[model samples]
Target: MAYEAKTKATDSSVLEFIENVESAKKREDAYQLVDIFTEVTGYEAKMWGPSIIGFGTYHYKYASGHEGDAPLAGFSPRKAKISLYFATEDTSREELLQQLGKHEAAKACVYINKVADINVAILKTLISQSVSFLQERYPNHN
Candidate 1:
């Protein structure tokens, strides 16, 4: 199957979605993320697709011609881990991750077993840096 982007903001209730998290621990972590992201970005949380909670917004068009809007920062509390979305292309991402506590990072996502396992201060820095990088690159964030 072709890849389809699953990260789009919807009118879905973020609070209700978090409430439905299967694990109590995950649900608590989701609430903490909402508070953290909101405080860091000064933007309200929005439900992205069925799983992700996102903050802020930015639009971009790639050289290959693809174009769309995406959240400046976001996270999803999956059954196994909480997936954090960040601008990993930023040069400082690696340095930040080194201090982020236990995490598994792919190209753009950081997977952590729980929020308690990570440094909240470093998470805030990551979110701030990602927003700054996106704002600089996209210039259409809000």
Candidate 2:
């Protein structure tokens, strides 16, 4: 059987999702992220799964034969923090994260309390770099 990805893009409204965020600050930050991500990636926002607002899409197949389609860049406004999703394989992400301001780094996600806590410029660079890296790595997907 083929591996199935739980987080698939849906036709759900991105704005609606943002508006539903429990925290007013996170809601506002989500709106700002929509603008920043759309502008930087040149892709409109789309809802991925339940919470993520994603831009662009890429299909990836690993050596193990597991494959799935995912957004090139995306974020989620959770209760405690905003989770920023970027390309994990990008070489420049580590250096860029250092300048990202107050944020917690996971393997592929960066968690920020709010947009005000981070450098927007660095975030833009990270988004651009992630898109570029994914496009390069998975040329056919983009």
Candidate 3:
């Protein structure tokens, strides 16, 4: 399925999400993640996949023969944790993640429970690096 971008402004539901969670800690974490992504990717925030606040975007294809488009790097502020989408798995970032302080990685994203749990600077750098890495792999990505 093709991903659809949010055409309307950031809605009240997202705001309600922030308020309903009622945790200053989580709200602060979401703010930090957004700031980190902006600083690294240099792309302004945009709503993606309903809850995701995405940065840059790129087209991609997996070896499994599945191919599609996705945010070059981004994250979602789910109630449980922050999902950081780097979209590329590169060994070069393995060492960087060690320097990133605290975080966990799934197949395509770095998961953080809170911003205080990780080094914001290193996270920003990693996101930027991942975008560059994917761009090298997919030049048409924009």
Candidate 4:
């Protein structure tokens, strides 16, 4: 199923949840991510779906016949780690990923536990690169 933001319910329970994490480190990581995303995307933070903090918007269709609208770029705070969604399983990001500090890649996203584990400069570059990629792919995304 596709994700939907409950616009009518702008509850910030997600922020509270992140703030109340058992570990101070994790909470700080979340805060840093929020700051980085805000600085780069220029979009105020908001919880999308359930655990994701999304930046921008983009509508996408998969070749496998699935179609949906999603954040142009976003991240999810999972139990074990954080997943940064950028490009899908395409090799277009291969070179960039190689320059990344430490991260795991999935079919459509990049996974990391903490911001300190990776280069903030590189992460910012990836965000910009991914946004550009999606914008070029979907010109009407704005």
Model 1, 7-70: lDDT tens digits are 6889999999988899999999999999999999889999888888889999988887777889
Model 2 steric clash pairs: none
lDDT of 4 by residue, 26-125 (tens): 7888888888888887767777765777777776666766655566677877778888977633564787788777889877788887888898887887
Model 1 lDDT on a 0 to 1 scale: 0.90
Candidate 3 lDDT, 28-125, residue by residue in tens: 77777777778888887776656777777777676766666667777777777778888545676887788877788877777888888788777877
Candidate 1: regions farther than 4 A off: 1-5
Instruction: Assess candidate 2 and give its TM-score to the true structure.
Output: 0.97
Assess the local accuracy of residue 77 in candidate 1 as a C-alpha lDDT between 0 and 100.
91
Residue pairs with backbone atoms closer than 3 Å in model 3 (clashes)? none
Runs with alpha carbons beyond 4 Å of true place in candidate 2: 88-90
TM-score of 4: 0.80
**TM-score quality measure for candidate 3:** 0.77
Candidate 1 is scored at a TM of: 0.94
Looking at candidate 4, what is the lDDT of residue 57?
72
Give the local distance difference test score of model 4.
Answer: 0.74
Task: Count backbone clashes in candidate 1.
Answer: 0
Whichever of 2 and 3 has more TM-score, that candidate is 2
User: How would you order the candidates by lDDT, starting with the best?
Assistant: 2, 1, 4, 3
The 0-to-1 C-alpha lDDT of every candidate, in the order given, reads 0.90, 0.93, 0.73, 0.74
